[model samples]
Target: MSATHARKKPFLRLATAAVAMVAALGMAACSGGASTSSSSSSSAQVGDRSPEQIKEAGEIVIGIFSDKAPFGYIDADGKPAGYDVVYGDRIAADLGVTAKYVPVDAAARTEVLASNKVDITLANFTVTPERAEKVDFANPYFKVSLGVVSPTSAEITDVSQLAGKTLIVTKGTTAEAYFEANHPEVKLQKYDQYSDAYQALEDGRGDAFSTDNTEVIAWAIQHPGFSVGIKSLGETSYIAAAVKKGNTALLDWLNNQLVELGQENFFHKDYEQTLAPVYGDAATPDDLVVEGGVDTTSTN
Candidate 1:
């Protein structure tokens, strides 16, 4: 489809289809609204429990990306591993439960939490005011800015250079909204996953891919010839964990947990385990880690 036509109407349809995957899983799992379970625990339900209830259950299911690396992804052993997963492990441990992770994409992470498909989400979730209206966010845990990655051949050094080029972005990401509102001259090709957007860039189907500065930088370092040419392009933002709106008990517990974790430099440990091996000295802890709700970047 032409970019303009897709932008005018069909983009929402595609975004909905791509992110509302839990609904699809529900359809495949059982007859209408009937319950299902894993051997270890029951399926999650929306806002049905308090923190005490969740702790009693002995397991907390979390939604996280299985494709985006450094934050969340599948490891060589085919298990979820990354900064988010490592932090999730700590969350579960603090609550005296085991952590079970469900795959999520940027577009669907909030929906999964709202539907009770997961108790919490740590998929590099940014704390925008619009999202805060839909779900409650914990204290900010990481700071980020928009970044654009293009092949050195394209030489896209700044936002202005995007004038007539196509920039690939993930559905439901801030980058998609940024280009639409601020750089309407640039054509956008939105995909469901970051991996897909990056693949489009690799295949020469899109001139560049834009997302969180931290992520694209790590990706560029791991690959070759591509670099994060435009870092800090849009309003600075923060990433945080989220829960269903009004889930106060769980939200409060998470906030307290985050404070304690910060006191211990917990995210630094997570970075070492999940990020350092790939990033080496390319990124310092301060570059991505936000502690104790301290990163108060304006989301307005």
Candidate 2:
């Protein structure tokens, strides 16, 4: 676990135990796979990997979260597993290449792409104007807003309740930026990983934890003592895969793939398989999932 990266391995069919394992192990990072093309050498100043180059290499390197569950996380078999992992697999399969997962933190999503360390980032990355300037975002596949969870005994039901209390947030997330810009009175405690942010909340180091509403809802359901009192805060945003700036070939490929897959309602099916079970009756697909590349609700 001290190593920064977990070696690549194929996901197993029986991955039900991965959630508990990832929770226990604190989301182990996965190492980047070797590039097959000279243009892809991480040591060199390279452009994003094109679809042809990836297919030629027989693998596509993807950046994803190794800690956040339902969306992205390491499975029991110690491989990348979760909704994004499943989607990444589909992307690779369609392109006739293997998926090489590189576990990433929220803050590192763009860095990995900018350095050509990862070809695509499917790490629950929300689209923002600032990030769009640094990376090219494909059409959105998911959407969300901010939400806050706190101990049920003293639940934070409203933003006004956070008057003098500390709020835990993962670094580089919309939640951190939103509070920093909108609510200066709220004390902020930041962690680089969602796992650590939740740990701070559990330890009573913060009055509440905030992040994507979808994530807080899932987490609150799993933890008996916590409740997501502020279910939705901030503007509705879309999550999409991102590539290095100006990587039009890869970006276009991703956008087209999303549209083609949308024709079959692929994302909704993905929800049934991965998210539905986790959410149970607490949530529904319509509340979240964006099918194909279309995001009717997106203001961005």
Candidate 3:
């Protein structure tokens, strides 16, 4: 199988089963305007310097997903290669620093950044109020919507159909929080890693799997027997790089970089070059693909 095909096949089977369960149990419940504790009364203090200062430090370590395909993953040669990895390398190169890749899972992203294990987190993290309280987010570079996937044999159609069903989701993802607040009737099967939750779904553990629509669509395309039931369930949001709280200088630099890249349609080009093969004609407009800058204060 081709690399993309190999990467998506397994996820498709797993997602299909998990999504079915979510439908049966009901969608997750949603809480309006809920807030979490901030790291400090004042924004967490971080070093104030331009991008040049960070580069002069020799290397910029970026925390990235190690198993999620097309975002960040180890290639056949055992080197990190993915959309996030490509972006991280470009940022490092532009700053004249060596890019040191630190493999991180979903749950460890914030902790790694907080502890200074990595200078920045380029791990496809969704921007949410809960997370914003802990880490400073740069301008958003990409946007993705939530989607549900089910097996060919299942009858799930919309999010409402997920009443009282069991759904498998990767822990620490926006999908988890979204479902938890919106579909309280649905029982969630959470896993620390995507691979593990996906495996559980394949083993006849859940009814359906929930995640970004882009990811589900890619997986469905690779697996012939499965299909995405709810293509666009709700609001779409941008995915941004995470920096330590109160890192205004670094955050500002990243924001400027994003704005420049947006003006040149660099993110669109990256999507077309890296994501088009798997997504093909299914890709949406450039506006949906590129979200410009981050809005840290915005709740909606």
Candidate 4:
């Protein structure tokens, strides 16, 4: 070979060898990275826990209101105590797990479930089509309708009275949605917490407060100077346990649990124990309770 060609051949071979080494290293790094990623993804935990997983872990996280009395609340003992808590306890027991209660705000009900913060929400969660899009609702366990409570001195008996007055409402509740959609003329003073909304009403910041009929009635009974003027508003809605969307195992468990509990009249027993003291003659099981996920309103 010519001297020039001979010199070029060795340089080309060296360049080829260097390129091969770099390619091999690149392939090795890519393969290692892919293996590590696959392993990590398989081991990482995500999404809502299954019924089997909850039982295996020995605990089920339940979201409930810590302020809404007669339905869900923290009692004098500083423990979760109310109608929802009573039912939550039974649900945990039936599932062979401990119930860990988490206080959830009105607007965060669906969020808590979607974020996997709670396995079930029993916070008097009213069934609505919009909420159903984000979460799966179990068969209803209780019945409710909107109720407006106002001061005895200036009680608002009709929706017409609210045209110019500010009506207090807990944000993310059906009452807020109802009034906003139907009575836009009525200005609303919204609070994130039930306690805050009631406080606003008591402070005269708003002429009236609206929420679940069962809740307002119970609250009105306990408070001396307030009365539920509008006992029922909008369509009757049912309260049910909710799970993250696509959690079929947990949803099915809740539905089946309601049916099984119905056999023993579990909710009636719950009402008698948790709500009876507060509601007394103001409400009855037939009025607020749903047995076996069945709505007896039509039959009655």
Which candidate leads in lDDT? 2
Write one digit per residue (lDDT tens) for candidate 4, span 137-162.
99998988899999999998999999
lDDT of 1 at 290: 77
**Number of the candidate with higher TM-score, 1 or 3:** 1
Q: Report the error of model 1 at residue 45, Å.
A: 2.9
Prediction 4 global C-alpha lDDT: 0.79
Q: What is the C-alpha lDDT profile of model 1 across 210-237, one tens digit per residue?
A: 9998888877765566878887788778
Instruction: Name the runs in model 4 displaced over 4 angstroms.
Output: 1-47
* Model 2 steric clash total: 3
Candidate 2 per-residue lDDT over residues 1-300, each given as its tens digit: 211112112122223344345444333223334335444444433336678877767777788887788788766666666889889999999999888777778998899998877788999999999999999999989889999999999999999999888999999999999999999999999999787888789899999999999988877766667899999998888899999999899899999999899899898899999888667777888878888788765555
Worst 10 residues of 4 by lDDT: 38-47
Model 3 Cα lDDT, one tens digit per residue, 1-300: 376567565445434443343222222111111121122213322233346555555456678776676677665445566778888987888788767676777888899878766778998988888899999988788788798887768846787777888888998887888998889988999998776766676676888898888777876777655678888876877799989888778888888888777677776677776777667777754635653574433467
Which of the two candidates, 1 or 3, achieves a greater lDDT against the reference? Answer: 1
User: If both were scored by lDDT, which would come out higher, candidate 3 or candidate 4?
Assistant: 4
Residue 3 CA displacement from its true place in model 3, Å: 13
